[model samples]
Every structure is written in C-alpha cells, then in structure tokens.
Target chain A: MNFKNFITHTLLLLLLALIQIIFLKNLALFGVAFCFLYLLGILNLPIPISHVPLILLSFGLGLAVDVFYDTIGIHAASASLMGFLRPYWLKAISPTGGYDDSAKPNLPEMGIGWYISYSLPMIFAFSLVFFTADQWGTGGFFGVLNKSILSSIFTVVLAIIVQLLFFKRRREIR
Target chain B: MLRILQFLYSLRSFLLFVLLEVLAIGLIVSNNSPQGAAFFNSSNAVIGTVLKTRSDILDFFSFAQANETLILENALLLEQIKALKQEPDSLPIPLDSAFEAQFQFTGARVISNSLRFAQNHLTLNKGSKDGIKPGMGIFNQDGIVGRVKSVSENYAVAISLLNTGLLVSSKIKSTENFGSVNWDGINSKQAKMLYVPRHVKAQAGDTIVTSGYNAVFPEGIRIGVISVVNPASDPNYLDILIDLSTDFSRVNYVYLVENTQIVELDSLHKKSEVVNEF
Candidate 1:
C-alpha cells in the first residue's frame, strides 16, 4: 500500500474503533444481539495484503477493542482467527475473472453479492469465536450459537450500512 | 534444511494464529483468577475517566430527577432531627457522631451501573483518596445498594445487590424471623429471601431489614418488603420474593458506610470461639 492509502486506512481503523467503543458498545438489541461495526476495518482491507500482516493487524484491532470492552483477550483472539481465514475466503469465492490488484474488497468495488458472500462468513467466524470465548463456562453450545448468529446478523447489517454511507465508488472509464 | 525451512514458512500463518490465541486465552485465564486487593477488572484510570465523562453527560439530562431525590432525602433527614429533639433526656448528636467512632460515611457518585448481567457491578467516583475502602457497605436514602469490592486511587467498584453472588443477612420486621436475601438473576426489581421457616407468618407487605448479624452493614437498614411467599420444595423453608426498596436504575449518589466496630467485634467473636473450644 502507498503511504497515502496506509495513512487513510489507519485513520479509518481508529475512527471505526472509537465508534465501536464509545457508541455501539452499549447498543444491544433484545439484550442478545450486538453490533460490531469495528470489524468493518478488517473486512474492508485491500485483497492483496498477505496473511502475516493481516493476522497481526487483526490481533492489534481486537486488542484495541478488548481494552475498551474490559474483556481481556476475547476480541483479539477472534479477530486473529478472522484474519487467518480471509485469504482462503477470497480464493474460494473468486469470480469468473480474477480480482484486479488495484481493486479493494468493499461494496463499491465489489457488487452486493460478492461482498455478502465474502464478508458474512468472516463476520460469522469472528462472532462465533468472540461469543464463545465471552460466554465460556457460563453458557451452553445452543446459547453460544444463538448469540453468534443473532450478533452476526446485527453486525453485518450495520457494517453494510456503514459501507454504503462512507465507501465511495470510483467512476468507470468508457 | 531447505525442506524444513519451506515447511516452516508454509506453516508460519498457522503458527502465528496458534501463538496469538494462546496469548489471548492466557490473558483471559489470568484475569479471571482470584487476585489480591488490586481492582484488576474495571477500575483502571483510563476506563474510569472515559466512563465518568459519559456518566457526567448523562447525569446532566437527569438533573431534575436527581434534584427531586435529594429534596426528598433532605426532608426525611429533617424529620428524623425533629423526632430526635422531641425525646426527653437524649441530647441531639450529629448523625455521624451518633454512630461509634469507628464508622465514617463517604459520599460517592455512581459513574457506571449495570443491571442486565447475572453479576452486575457499579463504579463509584470516590476511591482510596476519599477513604473508600473495600468491604464498606453502600446505601442510598431508600435502601442498601452493595458493598465495595475493590478500589483504585480515585475510583471504587462495588458489587451491586443485583449480583447473584451477594447475600444480605435480613429479617422480617414484624416477626423478626431471620433469613438471607439474594438475587435470583430473574428480575431486576425483585430478590429472593431464603432460609425463612415455612411456619413463619410472612405477609405480602412485611418489611425486610438487615439483621446486622454480618459486620458489613449496621442493624435495621431497610432492604426490601415481602412480595410473594410460597412453600419451598424442600418443605423446610419458604420461597419469598422481595420488592427491593432502592431503585438501582435511578441510584446516582450513595453513602459508603465504614463500620468502626467490626474489627473489635470480630476479635471478640474469635476469642469466644477459642474459649468454647477449650
């Protein structure tokens, strides 16, 4: 990534993390589902980034989140897992023509179908690990599953809305 | 060596993943373990300051409600003063002076509170600097809140009565039948009273007050009122519900009560135990 893009990504990550901690941390629906908009930073990373940096970034992001939530390491663990699986997910869902090096994996760069297919599994994986670690020894498997599914849905909806609001599309050349 | 290097390189991502997960789990385990008096959970300065700022903004919106509560408490205090003056020979002493020299009350503001968790906790703005120590009992004008769990320099975390782990030694006001009150984790507005014999005539409106058997709280602090009574399945006790007096959702200001005589009483009890053993 160029220095300009690197700076932009860092600023975006900070903004998303702040919003998650300050505002969305308290926003729970029915006391079960929670919105984790901070995952948008991880999900929207450029597709060409390698696995090591991606996983490290995920860990850092999760740790930042954990500091605010007062949860020691649960978010970091889950974010690392999500980062580890992102490359495989991109490879598995590659379109008829391969992804362009310049393309970013966002709503504007990729259509709704590709974005959902790519992001949903990553969000679900992250949520499953997160809620499982959070409710460990206190709740049963069914409870974990229910929380993960509901939270994933809430998180994905919020993430999509955020993308639509902030992620601008590049104009196509004739 | 080349093959081994290739293998290691190929598995580097997986290794990193495992290493990070182990570190995270290690942190979780260490955090959950019982540690000394250091309030490791939520009393950190940064988190406390952030929460305090948020609470301050929210407190601004609830100014009117808070004012009403303060006015009511002031009126009650005045009435108590008037009643005390009516007595024949008793000299009027300051409220704090009336208690033994060992007890002190530190005023604290509740900066963060939670009711939804099975184990809920409240963060207060006063801490060690304000003489707020762990084991100090907290109460609002209406009733008992909880005891201090841990304290940082300027912040203290109290385990709220809504938490499942807290049990207040209590008795019915009319019959003086002793029991313990605990949260059943079902309702925020209600708690369960345990160990009361089934034969005790506990009515729906009977009041429950602290028995002062535990050194944590003084005698006769109001806890709640009996709301429901049913025979326990064990056939030895009654399953009673209490309508909690202190509306925890609205509790902002609280008094942290430090019992001065607890150490003396505890030592005396220990001595008596030794004598009995002999």
Candidate 2:
C-alpha cells in the first residue's frame, strides 16, 4: 500500500476504535445482540495482506479495544481467531475470476450477496468466541449460542449500514 | 534437523496464533480472580481520562435526576438529625472508643459501566489518589452496587454485582436466614440467592441485606428483595431469586465504603483457618 493509503487506513482504524469505545461499549439489542463495528477495520484490509501480519494487527486491535472494555483478553483471543480464519475463508469463497491485486473484502466492492456470505460467518465465529469467553462456565451452551447468533446478525446489519453510509465505493473508480 | 526447522518456519502463522491464544487465555485466567491486580483495564491513565470525559458530557443530561435524588437523601438525613437532637439543657455523653465509626465513605462518579456482559464492571472517577482502594464496597441510595476490584492512580474498576463471579454474603431480613447473592448471568435485574435451605421461610418480598460476615460491607446494607422462590434440583437448597434494587443502567453516582478494620478482621479469619469467600 502507498503511504497515503496506509495513513488513511490507520486513521480509519483509530476512528473506528474511538467510536467503539465511546458509543458502542454498553450497547446491547434486547440484552443479547452486541455490535462489534471495529471488526470492519480488520475485515476491509487489502486481500493480499499476509496472514502473519494480519493476525498480529488483529491481535493488537483487539487488545487495544479490550483495554477499554475491561475484558482483558476476551476480544484479543476472538479477534485473532477471526483474523486467522479470514484468509482461508476468503480463498474458499473467492470469485471464479479470483480477486484483483488490491481487492478489499468490503460490501461496496464485493457486492451484497458476496459480502453477507463472507462477513456473516466470520462475524458469527467472532461472536461465538466472544460470548463463549465472556460467559465461560456460567452460561449454558444454548444461552451462548443464542447470544452468538443474535449478536452476529446484529453486528453484520450494523456493519453493512455503516459501510454503505460511510465507506467509499470503489466500483465508481473502476 | 534442517527439515524440521523448514517445517516449523512454514507453520509460523499457526505457531504464532497458538502463542497469542495461550497468552490471551493466561490473561483471562489471571484477570478473573477477584483479588488479581489486572494490568490492562479501563483503570489505566489514558483510558480512564477518555472515559471520564465521555461521562462528563453524558452525565450532564442526568444532572437533574441526580440533584433530585441527592436532595431527597439530604432531607431524610435532616429528619434523622432532628429526631436525634437533644434539648439545649441536656448534658452531652462522651462516647467510648467502641462507638467509633469503622467505615469511611467516599463519593464518586461512575465514568464507565457495563451490565450487558455476564462479567460486568464499573469504572469510578476516583482512584488510589482519592483514597479509593481495592476491596472497598460500593453502593448508592438505591442499594449495593459492587466491590472495588483494582485501583489505579486516578481510576478504579469495580466488579458489578451483576457479574456471575461476585458473591455477596447476605441474609433475608425477615427470617434472618443467610445466603450468598450471586448472578446467574441471565437477567440483569435479578440475581440468585444461593444456599438458603429448602426449609427456610424465604418468601417473596423478603428483604436481602449484607450480613457483614466477610467484612467487605457493614451489616444491613440493602442488596435486593426476594422476587421468586422455587424448589431447586438440589433438594437441600431452595432456588430463590432477588430483584436487585440498584438500577445499574442509570447509576451515574456511587458511594464507596471502606471498612477500616478489614485487615485485622481478615488476619483473624486467616488465623482461624477460615476462608472469606466474598
């Protein structure tokens, strides 16, 4: 990535983290669904980003968010898991023509159908890990599953809306 | 050796993933203990300042309600003082050292709080600098809130009563039957009262208050009211649920109470080989 691109991505990440810590910290829909909008910061990175750096970046991002949430390691563990899974999931769901050198896995570039299929499972995995760790031996399996499913759906819907409203469309440039 | 080294290099990402996961789990385990001094939390200086700023703006909207509550509390205290006042001619009695106060109270604003998670916590604006210390009990006019888990220089984090991990030693005021009030992680407004025997007359509407057994809270601090009583799967105990009085959602201000003689009390318990569970 160019220096300008790097700077833009870094600022976007900081903005997302700030929004997450300040606005979304205590938010829960019906006391079960939680939105993790900050995941978009990692999810929107260029397709060719290597796995090692991607995982390290995700771990750092999660740890930063975790410090604010007072959930010391839960987010760090889950977000890194999502990061570890991202590359494989992307390859498995790649388009027949495959991705461009600078393709980003965002809604505007990947289209709604592709985006939902891509993000939903990844988010679901993230929510599962997060709630599992949060609830840890206290909640039953069904309770964790219930929270994970609802939270993933909630996060995905909000993430899509945010991308649509704020994220620039690359298709117009093409 | 060369082949093994090459294989390890090829699986570097997986190894790093495992290493990071293990480190994260280690943090989780260490941070879960009630007495553990956590390093990375909202109590850190930079994060605390940010949270305090956010609450400063948000607390403005709740100022009227907080003022109303404070006024009501002041009026109640005034009435108590009036009732206890002696005639001008009456001789003052000098109280002995036994009558000295054992708890110190400090007022603090809750800069950040979360109730949605199974393990909820609250961040207070006061810290060690303001005489806020770990193990101090927090409450408001509504009821008991939580216990201070860790304190930084300018901020403190308390494990909320709604957290599943915290257990407050309490009793039913009407029957004097004691139990531990624990969150079952289902409802934010309700918590489970454990170890109340099946035969104990723990009826609905019975008040639950701190028993002062653990010395974290003084006797008779309100916890909640019993909302549900049912037979448990374990025939020896009753399943009793309480409706927590503290409206955690809107808890912007809190009072911290530190037991002055807790060290002595704890050391006594240790000498007797007793575990203080709360």
Candidate 3:
C-alpha cells in the first residue's frame, strides 16, 4: 500500500466535496448540475488494495455528505457498491495493467483516451448507483432513473473538465 | 447446470446492484411502518438537525414577506376592533370547540412552510412541551393552515392545507352545507371540493368554512371561498375551485388549539367499547 497514493486520494476527495458543497451545488446549467464529483477519488484509487476497505471508505464519505445535506443512507449505499465493484471492473476493462501501483489515474499518467475509457464507465456505474439510491428514498423508480441519468451526465462532464484543467496541466511526470 | 452457474457468476454485480437498491427501498418502505422507520428517517437526531439548520437558513429569505403579512393582519384586526366598538350588541366571534370544551390558546410561530410542492408541510416553533399535540388545529387571524402531524420537545410539524394527503371537511359559509376540500396539487391558491353535489346553489364568491364533520377542526372556521363552480362537470357532484382565504406563503404567527376534554372523551369511548346493538 503506497502512503502517497492514499494521501492524494484522501485530499482529492475532500477538495471535490468542498467544491461540490460550496460552488457546484449552486451552479445550474439549464437546471442540471454536478454534485457527486467526490466519487472520482474512490474511482481513481488503484486496484488490489483490498476492495472492502475502499468500499467502506466510499460508504463513509457518502454518509458524511448525507449528514451534511439531510438525505439518509442513500448515497452511502450506492457509493459502497461502487467501491466494492471497483476492482472487478478495473480488471475487466484494463487487463494490460494500465494504472500504476504507486500512481493516481490522471491524463499525464494514463493518457487522455485511456483515462476517458477507464473513468467514463466507472463514472457512469457509480453515478447510476449513487443518484438512483438518493432518489429512491424520496422518489419512486422513474424518478430515480431520471435523476440518475441527468446527474451522471453532469458528473462525467465535470470529471473530464477537472481531469483536463487541473490535473492535466499540473503533471510533472507520466 | 454449469452454464447456468456461470451465468449467475457473471451477473453477480448486477444482482448486487439490485440488492443494494432494494435495501434502500426497504429502508423507505420500512420507514413508513411505526417501528422499522426510526432508523433511517429524519427522526434520526443528526438528520433532523441538518434539515432544521438548512430550513432555518432558507427561512431567513421569507422573513420580509412574513413581516408584511403580520403587519397587515394586525392593522386589519385593529380596524375590526375599532369598528366593533362603534357597532354594539355584536359579541366578538369565538374560535374553536376547545373554548366550549375549556382549553386554552397555545401560541406558536411558523418555523417552516412549503407552498409550491405537490405535498406540503409546515413546521412550527412549538411542541408537546408547549401543549401542542398531533391533530391540534393551527390557524392565524385569517384562517386555517393545518393540524399538527408530528411533535417533538420544542417543535412540531403539520400536514398543511396544501398537502395532497389532507382531506378537510368544510362548509359553504351561507348554507353551512359541508363538503370535503383537498389540494388538487396544480395550484397553491386553489383547492377543490368534489362531492359538494350540484343541487345546492353555489356561487363564484361564496365563502367556505370548516364543517366540523371531523374532530380535527371545529365548525365555521374559514377555509376559502368558491372562486369557480362548474356544476355540469359531473351529474352528481359539482366541480368547485376555492381561492384560499389565507395566503399561506405569508403566514407567521399561529394559535395551536388544544382540547383538554379529549382525554376524557377517549377514556369514555374506551369504557363504552362494547356497544349493545339491542
């Protein structure tokens, strides 16, 4: 287990959460907004560091958000599943060891196309699960599906923007 | 069997996704029950505090409108008081059956209210400690808002007139003929009474008041007026639209009416549980 990678993952998740709470929540483009960017931190974590711990971490992060926002364990349950399934999906998608053991998933490290391919599916899966659970408590099946799709699309776009803008330029090495 | 087992193994993620989703649904459905609900509901102290704080922040913006409404209502009350002095022999109108039943006014402030939602609720700044109980009627000088639904130590939440779940028994002010009024969910200013029957002569301006068919509210408390009446919409019942007398978006101060006789009535009813049909 690389200590630097864990620290990077924690800092990134907290920063995304801060941005989501303070800024992006109030930002609406035609009433569609991104809020679950913090999931990227979990998604970007390297595989084989025991999936259970990461899933628990995602669950905790989601519960923290719910506590702040007054939704129940909806987000927590969704993110937990995403974290549990993370390793299996990573193995299935990237058999060539695309991600480094000591590194984070960024454009400079994995290239834009590999990053896009890797991140988009995880982003979709996680967002689909996260917003769907968030809605199930308040809204029924159709409502959950609608919010899941909209939030997932918005999340993916923002995830790419964050990838291209902040992490893309700051990379000192591949 | 091996092929089926392989298929099951391949589909484990999808099944797990569904299982998690069901857990959430189960949480919600179980929350509807009396006991299984407390775990994940807003009853949780942390969730309640968060919602309370967020609502408090949102309530700040509505203060200006609320103040203007209170001032207007106060001025109108003063005017009525002055007018009553000029015209004697007219006793001041009494409110609530609780007065007849010998209960007192429980003062409470509007903490939170939602107008635009399909289902709406209001939270008041008083609760069981202040003698506010569930099913106690809440009102201002103008008219009814709702009855308390849930109560805590220092606060209570109400199912408002704007709620789709609420079915209030009301009467036309002139005839006192009763009907059931509910929010149609399309308009905040309008509610509809479906089973009023077309036989009665209802006009566009007739006032509606509580009919006291139910114990929730006393008779003659104002609800709204018949703003639009389509008698021909259905043969048996008239389709009536009501313009609410009280602007809910502006309500602030309210009186929570508590009936002390309820305990006695409940005890008597419990004692008389076995009725002799003969």
Candidate 4:
C-alpha cells in the first residue's frame, strides 16, 4: 500500500477501535448479539495484503481491544484466526474477472452479493471462536452457537451500514 | 537443509498463526485462574486513562441519578449513626480487642464495565495509589458488585459477580443455609446459589447475603433474592437462582471494602491447609 493509504488505514483502525471501546463495549442486542465492529478494520484491508502482516495487524488490534474489555486474550486469538483464514476465503470467493489490484473487500467496493458471500462466513467463524473461548467449560453448545450466529448477523448488518455510510467507493478513492 | 528451509519459509504464516494462538491461549489460561495476577487488562495506565475519560463524559448524563442515590445513601448512613449514638451522660467503656474494625471502606468510580461476555469484568478508576488492592470486596447500596482482581498504580480491574469463574460465599437470610453464589453464564440479572441442600427451604423473594465465611466480604452485605428454587439434575444440590440486587448494567460508583487482617486470615488458612476461595 502507498504511504497515504497506510496512514488512512491506521487512522481508520484507530477510529474503529475507539468506537468499539467507548460505545460498543457493553452493547449486546437482546443480551446475546455483540457487535465486534473493529473487525471491519481487518476485514477491509486491500486484497493484495500478505498473510503475515494481516495476521499481525489483526492480533495487535484485537489485543488493543482486549486490554479495554478485560478479556485479555480472547479477542486477539479469535481475530488472529479470522485474519489467518481471510486470504484463503478471498481466493475461494473471487469473482470471474478476479479482484482489481487495489480492491478492498468491503461492501461499497465489492457489491452486496459478493460482500455477503465473502464476509458472512468469515464473521461467523470469528464469532464462533470468540464465544467458544468465552463459554469454555460453561456447557451449552447451543447457547454458544445461538450467540455466534446472531452476533455474526448483527455485526454484518452493522458493518454494512457503517461501510455504506462512510467508506468511499473504490473509484472515488483511487 | 535448503529444501527444509524453503518448506519452513512457505509455512511461515501458518507457523506464526500457531505461535500467536498459543501465546494468546497461554494468556487466557493464566488470566482465567482467579488467583493469578493479570498482566494485560484495563488496569494498565494508558487504558485506564482512556476508559476513565470515556466514563467521565458518559457519567455527566447520569449525574442527577447518581446524586439522588448518593443522597439516599447519606440519609441511610445518618440514620444508622443516630441509632448508634451514645447518650451524652453515658459512661465511656474501653472496647475489647474483638471490637476493632476489621474492614476499611473506600469509594471508587466504575470507569469501564462489560456484561455481555460470560466472564465479565469492570475497571475502577481508583487503584493501589488510592488504597485499592486485589481481593478487596466491591459493593454499592443496592447490592454486591464484585471483588478487585488486579490493581495498577491508578486503576484496578474487578471480576464482576456475573463472571462464571467468580463464586461469592453467601447464604439465605431467612433459612440461614449458606452456599456459594455463582454465575451460570446464562444471564446477567441472575446467578445460581450452589451446594444448597435439596432439603433446605429456599424460596422466591428470600434475601441472600454475604456469609463472611470467605473472609473477602464482611457478613450481611446483600447479594440478591432467591427467585427460583428447583431440584437440580444432580439431586444432591438445589438449583436455586437469585435475582442479583446490583444492577450491573448501570453500576457507576461503588464502595470497596478491604479486610485489614486478610493477610493474617490467609496465613491461618494456610496453616490449616485450607484454600482461600473468593
């Protein structure tokens, strides 16, 4: 990425982290669906980004959030898993013409159908890992799965709303 | 050797992922144990400052409610003082050593808190600098909140009573049957009272209070009211649920109580080969 793009991404990551810590910390929809909106910072990175940096970035961002949430390593572990899987998921779902060199896997740039197909399962995987770690030895697989599914759906809806409202279209940004 | 190096280089991302995941899991395991000191949490200086600033802004909107609660508490304390006041003509008697104060209380602001997670925690603005220490009991006028888990220079992190790992020693006020209050990880407003015998007459609306058995909290601090009493699958213990008195969602200011003689008590327990459960 260019220096300007790197600066913008870092700022965006900071903004998302702030929102997650300040506003979304205690928010749970109907006491189950939690919004891990900061995942968007990792999810929307340029497609050409290498796996190593992506995993490191995800781990760092998650740790920053974990420090605030007091779930010390839970978020970091889950976000790292999500980051590690992103490249494979992106390759599997790449469209016929394939992604542009500068493509970002976000709703505004990737269109709704492709974005849903790409982001939903990744988010589901993230929520699954998060709730699994959280509910470890607590028993009730159904409860974990219920929370995971609802949280992923809730987070995706919120993520889409945020991207639609704020993120610039690829053409406009370029 | 070059071919093996090439293969290792090819699997670098996977190896890094495994390394980081192992590191994170290690942190989780180390931090999950209630007695282990937490290394990374809101108790850190920078995170504490950030959480405090956020709370400061949000608390502004709730000032009137907080003021009303504080006034109510003040009135209650004044009434208690009036009841305890000695008559002016009464002769002063030297108190026995048994009458010495065992617990000291301090006030703190809840800067950051979370309830959605199964293992929830809260961050208090006061820390070791303010006489806050790990294992101090936290409560409000409404009910018990939690115990301090770890403390930094200017902040402390507390495991909320809603955390599945925290078990508060408690008893039914009516029946006098004591048990451990444990969060079942299913709900925030309710917690399970474990080890209550199946024959104990626990009922809905019965009050639960700290038993003083654990030594972390003084006796008689309210915990909650038993809302459900059922025969558990274990058949030996009762499945009793208590509606937690502390409204954790809006918990702002809290009173922390530190036992001055906890070190002595802990050492005594150690002498007897008993584990300290808090």
How well does chain A score by TM in each candidate? 0.96, 0.96, 0.79, 0.96
TM-score of chain A of 3: 0.79
**Candidate 4 chain B, which ten residues in sequence have the lowest lDDT sum?**
B226-235
- What's the residue-level lDDT of A54 in candidate 4? 96
lDDT of 3 by residue, A1-174 (tens): 568767877888888765654445334444333457777777766655665467667767766664333244556677777776777776776747465554555555667687667766666666666555433343456644555567677776777787777764544565
Off by over 4 Å in 4: A172-174, B276-278
Please identify model 3 stretches exceeding 4 Å from their true place. Answer: A1-170, B1-23, B33-37, B40-62, B80-125, B137-147, B155-166, B171-210, B218-255, B264-278
Model 4, B99-128: lDDT tens digits are 999999999999998888889999999989
Listed in order, each prediction's TM-score against the native is 0.81, 0.98, 0.62, 0.97
Per-residue accuracy of model 1 over B92-114 as CA lDDT, tens digit each = 66566455466677788998876
Shares of reference contacts reproduced by the candidates, in order, are 0.48, 0.83, 0.13, 0.84
Q: What is the lDDT of candidate 2?
A: 0.92
lDDT of 2 by residue, B1-278 (tens): 99999999999999999999999999998899866769789999999999999999999999999999999999998999998899899999998977789999999999999999999999999999999989899999989999999999999999999899998999999888888999999999999999988889878999999998888888899999999899857779999989999899999889999999988888998899998665
Q: Each candidate's lDDT (Cα)?
A: 0.83, 0.92, 0.67, 0.92
Of 2 and 3, the candidate ahead on DockQ is 2
Residue pairs with clashing backbones, model 3: B31-B37
**Which candidate number maximizes DockQ?**
2
Collision pairs in model 1: B102-B260
- For residues A1-174, what per-residue lDDT tens digits would candidate 2 score against the true structure? 889888988998899999999999999999999999999898988888899999999999999999989899999999999999999999999999899877888998889999999999999999999999999999899999999999999989999999899888766643
TM-score of 1: 0.81
Model 4 DockQ (Cα-based): 0.86
Angstrom error of the Cα, residue B188, model 4: value is 0.7
